[model samples]
Target: MSNDGHPMKGHRFVAWLIAAGIIAASPALADTPTGAARELATKTCAVLAARVDEIPGSGPVFLRSYDSSFGQGPTAEPALANAAFTYDNALAAIALTACGHRAHAQRIGEALLSAVNLDRAGTKGRLRNTYRAGAQTQRPIPPMGWWDVVASRWFEDPYQVGTATGNVAWAALALLTLSEVTGKTRFRDGAAVLAEWTVQHTRDGQGPDGFTGGVHGYDDAPQVLTWKSTEHNTDLVAVFDWLDRAGAPGDWSHQAKAARAFLDAVWDEASGHFFVGTTPDGVTVNRAVSSLDVQLWPLLLHGALERWQRSLTYAEGAHAVDGGFDFNDDRDGLWVEGTAQAALAFRAVGRATDADRLLAEVAKELSPSGYIWATRQPSISTGLAIGPSSATDDFRYYRRPHLGATAWAAMAALSWNPFTGQRLQPVRVRTTGSK
Candidate 1:
């Protein structure tokens, strides 16, 4: 079955139905956190692999985001058709690899590498923001360039294809893992290039606050530099560490140190939480934002027991509901990706019971046919934006199955680290590696 829970056509559909029936019949199989996670991962991966459109040289490109209003013309146009975001595909590759699907992981990795567009001047080995599966005369894919907000929104760029630090970090991590899994030098070479480029662009001591957050890629028009993301820098720390562990030649100590310094500068000591990030001018942004990812990511990747406890308490009290976690403290609806990610974080921090509970909550969002919804809502909304929104209370896209969310659910189930494709286990404070 497709992610929408609609019956897919072809032999794959029949196989999927049989698989789903088996899963549904055996409630015991779905009772355990890992069992349910593996089942969902296997089933979802099969369907996603079957449905994806393969580019000749690039292999399969998973859908980045789905709009329920797809094919509905006039005011509502299809925004994400044939478009694949690098970061989403990277995460999918990690999840598939963790689930023992090396072929799928390699396919995704190759596709990402094949889709690389290196037109931007400032950065080397920079990937395009998004890639189209096939050419379309009516609405050809936008030209590759630096991130331009006006052009992006006006043109309806679905994946916001640009040189985002976070996206590149993820892509690099994915490539490194693919290299390890496939023993291919090309993938490792690709990861090294990205890592080197990232280190070059990193802002170490230039900022007023002595922050190490990297610049937010190149932007067009005004050509003004934008804010830096603490989350993205944290991701870079993990990326460099993974590359080092994989025996890549680069000396990643400096980059890792810089990334950690940026994270430290952004840490809110009193609150026991890290701030969202710093603006271009070095001022902190989103101090009031209470997002699950903002807290969970640091805890999962960089272990801080006290901070993890505090963040977990905050997430549970402020963002979590019966179904899942809200997008932020201010938002009323749950975000499926964040919830699944939080489950992994819980497991990493030795709170297996909490992790299992979260996994169970996510399991409730899965269809009998094994497709997991992006977000489960009490009712559907009439908004055009994808996923949940505060204004319209629209849940159409939220209720639909999403590639990224399902992949994250699979990752959470295995207690897999997205950075290294390793099973998550609690660790004490260490001095040997990047934290």
Candidate 2:
């Protein structure tokens, strides 16, 4: 049975193959650079398409974000067995779009639309960070959870049910991407709803002046997170700008400017890198840590590289681990998702060789199960907490086969920019030694 309790049919694989453009009549896979990239992209899309095929009768269906590792058999990792993270699903939607799988992309898009219209505990326009991973058969859609036989109660992870600014912006980006690809107004309109919720709830005017971290629980009155994130603001800069370009009303240009201003404020002139963001005070810069995505994602903004290219240097210096990239400055291990993100950022800046180097690292992470590993180590510390109740910095990525990492790898292989839906042109290949 699917996550929504619907029985699935096995005949969908052929249709999925046709949608993925992998019919038998297709040209033979080549050995050159472009051919190699296409091969990687085709394999990655096949992984995603197989996930989409697991659900039936869906206006909105979600694919689980992570699968158990190679030796874990067919059972999902218990912690995230039913969790379809909005951010991961959004990345999958954009990756499918980039790979020319419109029908599959539309299924995830419909799921995002369903989330936008059906928050079980909040106002209609907002989305939780995650939902149950399957077809939406229940009204107001269900958040992810499982029965705890030991505790004799249903257990829900608080972080999964909370709203995060970055996650919601990613959802909007996915919707807008679908709108651009399919020319559908409903997708665009759904993105507009997300934009409105973000502006109304998370907008902050404190020190740096951008969106906050969003709510942090599953209650009707969830705890409002006062912390501001450079990463979150970076996501909104792309989102608000896209909305403005789509002729979405309601001062979207000014909103974009506000988000951009926040990014500008967080730039550290001395280190030439962005600070992680503000503390809970929302007035003081949180210099306690560094994040890889915070440094690279902003570079994808239109014309941002021309102004903030130094951030790339900073990332190389601080986050590079072995041959790949890590999640934070400690550089303890390879973070496959961050490595893929760095590849796309490099490609965007005309560093095709640099992009290729990172993609090679990403390719090493491919698992026998067709999904990508989340990290090189058996477990890697992020130096962060998983939820408000966590006692310490207990958050970590294990050696799981991750859907999000695979989607990002596919994007990097296709040279597709998730934020803008435009392909980055590859220039002359120049080897830039070690990171």
* Stretches of model 2 off by over 4 angstroms after superposition: 1-36, 69-78, 426-435
Where does model 1 exceed 4 Å of error?
A: 1-35, 52-64, 67-76, 116-123, 134-159, 202-204, 207-225, 283-286, 302-306, 367-371, 378-399, 430-435
Top candidate on TM-score is 2
lDDT of 2 by residue, 151-232 (tens): 8998877788889999999999999999998999889889989999999999998787789989887685578889898999
Which 10-residue window in model 1 sums to the lowest lDDT?
Answer: 381-390
TM-score for each predicted model, relative to the true structure? 0.76, 0.89
Query: Pick by lDDT: which candidate is best?
Result: 2
Supply candidate 2's per-residue lDDT for 348: 77
Q: What lDDT does candidate 2 reach at residue 335?
A: 89
List per-prediction Cα lDDT, in the order shown: 0.60, 0.79
